[model samples]
Target: MDWEPHARRLADTVLRRRESRWWNVLASTPRHVFVPAWWEHGTSGPVARNGPDDPAAWLKTAYQDTTLITRMGTRHADHTTPGTLLPSGPWPTSSSTLPTLLVTMYRHAMLGPDSHTLVTTGTGYGTALACRRLRDPSLVTSIDIDPYLVTAATERLDAIGLHPRTAACDITTNLPGEFDRIVSTVSVRPLPASWLHGLRPGGRLVTTIAGTGLLLVADKADDGTANGYITADQASFMRTRHGDDYDTASPPPSVWDAADGDGDTVTTSRYPLLDVQNTWDIRSMLELQAPGIEHRFHRSTDGPRTAWMAHPDGSWARAAAPDRRTSPLVHQGGPRRLWDTLETIRDRLNRTGQLPVHGAQATITPDGQTTLRRGRWSATL
Candidate 1:
């Protein structure tokens, strides 16, 4: 089936403005070719879809301005059979990221006519877009830690008569070479030092903060320091990995079991129970204030709700409410008051209009020491 019309429609919606530099590049690329199969999270688990068996569904899904989960855990959808359902607990490790977000990262980099670019090779779709936009395949270098992903993406890219350098290496370590621009679909914490070292003088790098929806864009300087600001636009990507799968890091099960018990301190909350996982700004601010807090929420059919916050440091908080309109009964334990910190952040947001992390100024040293500042507020990660 012909897919050009769908691709064109996608470009119109994703780019929105016809004058966008990436409009033509996105319109001409065959996304379906790269995402021939993908995993869909169903209520039961993960459901697989094979493009060859369902052409109409494939075109419809591929052309939409939505992400297609190509890999869940270590299993790539391409290797899974249709109608297969896998138990779902593992998070998505890779995807053909939504077109709009990819364009946003590219635009932030401000790719020049002759810019040599280093980009993530997930599904190779983003690299194809870069190749088309640059009009020279040789100017692009794509990398992924997974050897299988690199091999598959290389073949798919070659199938479209586009060939660029593809490497299987952890981006957090030493990079393959210097480039004018670096755009990563994968997120990282503290900004990788190797990325800054591999960047040519005056080079720009665009990536997201690991645990927050923070899009960071910075340019290297002659002094080996980079300075920039977080973009107002929000985006999140899977954190970078050095192995086949991310290392499992969670609070001990005993901490979760004790969260509901009587705490060292218990009181009524000033605000109604909130699922921090669903509130981006609050979640982002909380992450900035105290990193590595895992949130969980449960709502009963009758109306009662419970929210939990757990940290690997043995800190835990639980709040329960009869309904959304009522304040929750709170409990806390461990080295710090996790819930109180969240409330303080929420209070700041309520009292003031916004959080300092949004659009904050970012400065990075030669060794990847990152400092974000806004007025009197500052944080180093």
Candidate 2:
């Protein structure tokens, strides 16, 4: 598919100067073999990005490091072979994650040569990298909720003379074995106690705590409570889905009402093109502290930009400004000013050059409240 040149550039640009362990894994693995076909979201629905009807543009996207929506709205794109095109659907059910972020999460996973690793497999790209780095099938067990995905991953990994124990298992429930490291590409709202139960003492676990945050890395403790730090990066994968996949959560009626308010404050922000989704320090901290909020940003072709933040708890914020450089006019209602919280965090980062997400102390309680403390600021997610 002529993807090697692009893959090599990605390795040099993204992985170069990163942790050697993660860099080696990213450079060694062949990504294209694992994702032969994928799905893309369109205005009307989810469309196949492979096969005879698929355009060269579609193939380029499918092979890139970017996430490709492979299924949505009652259809699975992976089942579409090399000569058929499936219509695009409403939401993304699955995807191959960004290559850079995948490596970033792995860097935090702290997997060593001898470490037994448990990873959630999707397109099997990540699992392939794990196999290449660990080079020991018995030390790595990759699981996925879909049996078809597991079977496909097994075959693909085998093609490269790499094999790991593959299983169609739900990670939110019991895992198959105790391991030295556990990393999940899927997001879960609460930290699973089964993860803690499956780890040997002093083992490490890296995952995105469902509902609000970034990658969390911690070592298993003697008392059963693990302690570690949040990574200085942020990413969101599709939420773990069961049965017929994720049903939309009930919306809070008061959010729309709050968006229609005039009592909220209006001001310009210092940063333009917030790119909150791309900010490692800010996003990781926010996810850990307030994972319930979903973010939305809109920029018109003419340049008027508006951003919104909504929480399931009836809290919401909307900010609009004429240009990226102008301070946003913010309207917030319910419990707090969401943008204000973010700006406060930005100001902290401005003063310190970075938030303390990387070195912060994390204490996982028996109830799944992860408390992170850095200097005078402390938060629970």
Candidate 3:
């Protein structure tokens, strides 16, 4: 069955419910061709999905407007045999980001006909779209830290009658070349100085901050600096890696389990129990306030809301609510009160009636010193 039409419809809805200039490119390009096989997120672990074995299901997943897990830990789906039971512990190392999110990032760049863009390479699906949009593959240069990914993506692009400059390099350490627009699907901690050096004056950069949904869309200035604001659209991406996997291993339950107990301060919270992962505004604020706080949530069989948060600094919080009508029982431990900080933020939001992060001013210096200021409060990236 032809899946191009189905893919096009999904792409339109993702691009603000309007017909995008890149619509035709998205329509014609066959995404399944690039990702013949992939890993699907399964309850037990990463499950392998084969293309030739189940062509129909493959088309359905390939055309869907969702991310397809392509790698788990350092094991790639392409390398895994079909129907194999893969270990689930390691976090997803790579994926073909939902087509919609790719459209959003492209739109954020506000690309011009003659624009030259430096982009990140994952499955090369986004790279293909960029090539199709510009109609000149040479105008686009893509990079990935994995040599295998770079080689496979290049070969796949060639198979589809499209070719662009692709490289295997650590983007944070050094960029491939100067470009008018620098867009990264991977998240970074502090804005990389190498990125600023690679972006031409009067150009734009769109990316997310590591551990947060904050999207930094900035443009280069004549004075060797870049400034912009956080987009209201909260976006998340895997942190950039210098090697096959993330440098910092996932935290064990022991680090956070200690915080789930009766804490130094045990009291009723003013608000209902909330899962930070589900709340964009408050989640982004908390991540900005305290970066690297792992968030999680659980529900009892009878339906009590329970939320937990833990950080590397030994800060942890747990909140539980018996029902919607009752306030949440709060517990916090460690050097900082995790729940209390969240409540303070929620309190500020209650009194101030707004989140300053949306459309807040963002400034990045040449040396990569970045800051975000909104009203009286300010924070460094």
Instruction: Kindly indicate the candidate among 2 and 3 with the higher lDDT.
Output: 3
Which order, best to worst by lDDT? 1, 3, 2
lDDT of all predictions: 0.92, 0.73, 0.85
Backbone clashes under 3 angstroms, per model: 0, 14, 0
Per-residue lDDT of model 1, residues 221-334, tens digit only: 999999999999999999998899988787888889889788999989999899998887788888888988999999987599999999999999999999898899999999
List, residue by residue over 2-72, the lDDT tens digit for candidate 2.
65665566667676765555665666676767776776555654456563354455445644667765556
Candidate 3 per-residue lDDT over residues 262-368, each given as its tens digit: 88889899887777888878988888888878888887765788888888778788888886667888888888888888999999999989988887899999988
Candidate 1 vs 2: which has more lDDT? 1
Local error of candidate 3 at 123, Å?
0.4
Error of 3 at 207 (Å): 0.6
Judging by lDDT, tell me the better candidate of 1 and 3. Answer: 1
